[model samples]
Target: MKMVFRWYGEGNDTVTLQQIKQIPGVEGIVWALHDVPAGEEWPMDKILDYKSKADAHGFHLEVVESVNIHEDIKLGLPSRDKYIENYKKTIEKVAKVGAKVICYNFMPVFDWIRTDLFHRLEDGSTALFYEKAKVDDMDPMELVRKISDNPDFTMPGWEPERLKHLSSLFEAYKNVTEEDLWSNLQYFLEQVIPVAEANDIKLAIHPDDPPWPIFGLPRIMTSQENLRRLLKLVDSPSNGITLCSGSLGANPRNDIVGMVREFADRIPFAHIRNVRVYENGDFIETSHRAADGTVDICGIVQAYHESGFQGYARPDHGRHIWDEQCRAGYGLYDRALGIMYLWGIWDSLERNKQEVGA
Candidate 1:
């Protein structure tokens, strides 16, 4: 596994590239032009600027966390074709900058949702938390306000521009269903996958944040069967999955190891993190240690090692550690710690294989 770190770029992020490069096994940064709105064509000069910065710091800019999908594409609006054309152009621009995998999602409106950004844990560290009952009872606008209350930092999915049209977005999805979402996603893949293949960039779709429908929004990328269906839609190596453990692990039944074994060849990127699920259906993001959470991170690593995974991987959704104030779920201290934990697992697997060979 080639470990990478997610850097939101200079000025936008508290963590610096210098700090990222100091992590023992991290060789690259999973990044994107966060300032650019979804569906707009990315300028070549801007892409190069990011590459130059990473190169200057001795880090590769080969994997992007996302190129946000336009809501028009997900909603299957009449204007989707134009946005898709722009998306294709952006894909070409990304390829030009040597990004091997472009991680994107097809979720409508909000990309990921959490009821609390800093729910205090038993250990005094804060983490991104989901309260099941509260989500069911809370008003949509109230939830949005709670998540975006931090004016100083920008949340990944809750873009201010998008949330500004909260009521309109909810109304627009009134008639859309799960099947509609699947068809729309297929339409997107059909248009974008060929271009991705031609550019030698794999399109890895990140699973829904909680792996479930939220606020009555249809979510399809939530389970193994759904992932299989998605892969078969394009039926190309370029069409792949990001294989996010924390997202899929929210549902205890998801066999992450089985997914690794089954989709090993098609997975080009991974977001490895842990979350402790409560009996009441709540969950809190935790450290990457296997024993600390419900996810079988150790078995997941073994599967990746046995399958000889050569793609990029990163530690996703870290806790707020050492009172380091930064983006919710994206503080540098815990994420750096998570990287070492993942590296420790990978090293043990490699050493065991060598011992067996000897």
Candidate 2:
């Protein structure tokens, strides 16, 4: 596996590329133009600028976390065609800059949701938490307010400009069902996959944050069967998956090892992280260590090793450790440590295989 680190650009992030390059096995950064709005074409100059920055820091710009899908495209509105064309152009731009994979999502209004940004864990470290009962009964607006109240760093999914119309976005999705979402996603894939193939950039779609519907939004990429269906929709090698462990692991039914074995060839990127699930249906993000959480991170890494996975992977959603005040889940200290943990697993596996062969 090719280890990559998620670096929010120059001033937007506290973790510098210099720090990222110091990580033992990390060779690249998973990035995107955060200031750019959805549906707008990404400028080639801006793409090249990031590429130059990564090159200057001796890292490759090989993966992008997200090129957010426009709500119009997800809603199948008439204006979707325009946005899609712009998306196609953006794909070409990213590919021109040597980015091999473009990770995006098709979730409606909110990309991901969490009840608490800093729920304190038993060990005194804080992490992103999801409270099941609270979410089921809580008002959607109240949840939005809680998530967006943090004015220090911008949350990935909860863009201020977009959430300003939360009521309208909710009303617009009143008639959109699961089937409607699937059809719209298929429509998007049909338009962009060909372009992605031509540009030699794989389009890896991230699964829903919790791998389930939230606030009545229809989430289809939540299970293995759904992923199979999504792959078949485009039926092209360029149309792929991001294979996020934390997202799919939220649903206990998802067999992540089976998914790695089944979709190994199609997966171009991965977000490997662990989460502790409670008996009451609550969950909290944890360190990448296997014993720290419910997810069998060791097994997942073993599957990737056995499969000879050569794709880009990163440690996702780290805990806020050492009193390092940074973005809720994108803190540097824990994630840098997480990368080392993953590298240790990969290194031991490789050494064991060599011993067996010898």
Candidate 3:
């Protein structure tokens, strides 16, 4: 596995490229032009600028976390064709900068949802927390205010500009259903998969953050079966997935290890992290240690090793440890620590394999 780190950008992130370089085994950055609105083609000069920065630090710009999908595309509006055309152009631009995998999601309204950004854990370190009750009971607008009012850094999915139309977006999605979402996603893939393939880039869709519908919004990328259906949508090697453990692990039913074994060839990127699920249906991000969370992190890594995975992997989300005031889930310290833990598991598996062969 080729380990990578997520860096927001120069001034937008607290963690620097210098710090990421110091992390052992991290060879690239999973990045995007966060300032650019979804559906618009990314500026070629800005893309080159990002490439230069990473190249200066000896990091490959192989993976992009997202080229955010326009709500028009997801909503299947008539304007979607324009956005889809722009998306095709964006794919070509990122590929020019040496991006091998482009990670995007089709989740409508919100990309990811969480109740508390800094929910304190038993160990005093905080992490992103998801409370099911809050989602079911609280108004999404209130939750939007809580998430979007941040002065520190822009949250990936909860961009203020997007949430500014929360009510309208929700109303627009009221008539949309799960099947409708699947059809819309298929429409998107049909148009863009050929562009991605032509660019030698795998278009990997991130699973819904909680792997479930929220605020009555339809979420289709939530389970193993749904993912299988997604792969068959385009039926091309370029059509792929960004398998996220913490996102699917929230439900406790998703067999992440099984998914790795089944979709190994198609997955160009993996987000390896752990989350502890409770009886009450809430979950909190935890250390990558298997004991710390419900996810079978060890087995998941083992599955990748067994499959001879040559794709990019990253320590997805981590706790707010050492009082490091940073992005809610994208901190330097704990993510670095998570990387070491993942390496420990992978290295031991390699050593054991060598021993068995000997």
lDDT score at residue 238, model 3, on the 0-100 scale: 97
Model 1 Cα shift for residue 70 (angstroms): 0.8
lDDT tens per residue, model 3, 1-358: 9999999999999899999999999999999999998889999999999999999999999999889999999999999999999999999999888999999999998988999999999999999999998889999889988987677797888877888988899999999999998899999999999999899999999999999888888899999999999999989999999999999999998999999999999999999999999999999999999999999999999999999999999999999999998989999999999999999999999999999999
How many backbone overlaps does candidate 2 show? Answer: 0
Candidate 3 stretches greater than 4 Å from native: none
lDDT of 2 at 202: 94
After the best TM-score superposition of candidate 1, give how far the Cα of residue 156 lies from its true spot, in angstroms. Answer: 1.4
**On residues 1-358, what C-alpha lDDT tens digit does candidate 2 reach at each position?**
9999998898889899998888888899999998888889998888888999999988888898789999999999999999999999998888777889999998888887789999999899999999999989998889888987887776777888888888998899999999999999999999999999898999999999888888788889899999999999999999999999999988887899999999999999989999888888888999999999989999999999999999999998899999998888998999999999999999999999999999
**TM-score of candidate 2 relative to the true fold:** 0.98
Candidate 1, poorest ten consecutive residues by summed lDDT: 148-157
Give the per-residue lDDT of model 1 (tens digit) for 1-358: 8999999988889999988888998899999998888889988888999999999988887898789888989999999999999999999988887889999998888887788899998889999999999988888999888987898866778888898998999999999999998889899999999999999999999999899988888999999999999999989999999999999999998999999999999999999999999999999898899888999999998999999999999998899989998988888999999998888889988898899999
Error of 1 at 148 (Å): 1.3
lDDT of candidate 2 at residue 212, scale 0 to 100: 85
- lDDT computed for candidate 1: 0.91
Q: Which residue pairs clash within candidate 3? A: none
